[model samples]
Target: MGKYAHLNILLAEDDSSIRSAIKAMLFDLGIHKITEAADGEGALQNLIRTPQGYDLIICDWNMPNKNGLELLKDAKMRAPSTPFLMITGRADEESVMKALKSGVSGYLRKPFRMNQLESKIKVIADSWSEMA
Candidate 1:
C-alpha cells in the first residue's frame, strides 16, 4: 500500500478530463477511496452526506452552481479540521490570497505533474502528523 492508502479524498472538479486524470494519479498513489463530484454543489452535498468526513478535499476554483471558494468556506465551517487543497488554473495573486483567507490548506496550479500533487499532499499529511 502507498503512504496515503488509508486516506479518503473528496475531489470536486467540473472538467471530466481533468477529474479523470487526477483520479488516475490518485489511484497510482494507492488512494482508491475517492469520492468525485462534477461540481462544487455536488461536492458539498457529498460532504454533507459523509458525516464522518473525508481525509482530504481537493477542489477546483470555478464550477457550476457553486465555486471552490464558496465550498471551501462552507466546508471549513462544517469541518474545520479537515484539510482542503485548492487545485485550479487560476494562478493570480488575488485568487491565491482569497483561497488562503478562506482556510485552504494548500494551493496547486493547473497542469501540475503527479510529483507536484504528491508533494502537496505530503505537506498536508505531514502537518496532520505533527498535530497528532
Candidate 2:
C-alpha cells in the first residue's frame, strides 16, 4: 500500500474530466479512499457530513455555487486541521496569494504533471502529520 492509502481525501472540482484525471493520479499514488463533489456547495455538504474531517481536500479555484476560495475559507473554519490544496488553471499571482492567505496547504497550477501532484500530496501529508 502507498503511504497515503490510509487517508480519506475529498476532491471538489467542477469539471468532470479534470476531476477524474486527478482521482486517477491519486489512485496511482495509492490513495483509493476518495470522496468527490461537483461544486463548492457539494463540497461543503460533504465536509459537514464528515465531522472528523478529511485527511486532505483538493479543490478547484473556479467552481459553481461557492468557488474554491470561498470553500477554502469555510472549510478552514469548520476543520482547521485539515489540509487543503487548491488546483486551478489560473496561475495568477493575486489568486495564489489569496489562496495562501486563506490557509491553503498547497496550490497546483492546472496541466500539472503527475509527479507534481504526488510531490504536493507528500509535502502536505508530511506537514499535516507533524501537526497531528
Candidate 3:
C-alpha cells in the first residue's frame, strides 16, 4: 500500500470522464476514501461540512458553478492545513503563477501519469510530515 492509502481526499471536476480517470488513479495509488464534487461550489460545501477537513483536495481548473482557483481561495480560509492539488489543462505561465500565489499545494498539468500524481502527493505528504 502507498503512504497515502489512509488519506481522505476530495476530488472536484466538472467532467465525469476526467473525474473517473483521476479517481481510478487515486485508487491505484491506494487512496480508497474519496469524496467527489461536481464543481467548486460542491467542493466548498464538502469542506464546510467536514470539521476535521480532508487530507487532500484535487480539483480541475474549469467548472461551471465555480473554478478551482476560487475553491482554493475559499478552502484556504476554512481548511488551511489541507493540501490542495490543481489538475488542469491550463499550462500557461499566468495560470500556473496564479495557482502558486493562491497557495496550491501542487499544480499538475493535464495528461499527467500516475507516477506524476503519486510524486506530487508524496511531496505534499513529506512536507506535512516535516512540519509535524
RMSD for all candidates, in order, please: 0.7, 0.7, 0.9
Per-residue error for 127 in candidate 1, Å, reads 0.4
TM-score of 2: 0.98
lDDT of 1 by residue, 1-132 (tens): 999999999999999999999999999999999999999999999999999999999999999999999999989988999999999999999989988988999999999999999999999999977886
lDDT of 3 by residue, 1-132 (tens): 877898999999999999999999999998999999999999999998988788899999899788999999999999888889999999999999999999999999999999999999999988977876
Local distance difference test scores for all models: 0.95, 0.94, 0.92
Q: Model 3: how far is 131 from its true place, Å? A: 1.3
Please report how far candidate 1 places residue 11 from its true position, in Å. Answer: 0.3
Error of 1 at 75 (Å): 0.4
Model 2, range 27-111, lDDT digits (tens) per residue? 9999998999999999999999997789999999999999999999999899988999999988889988988998999999999
| Alpha-carbon runs more than 4 Å astray in model 2 | none
Clashing pairs in 2: none
Name the lDDT of candidate 2.
0.94
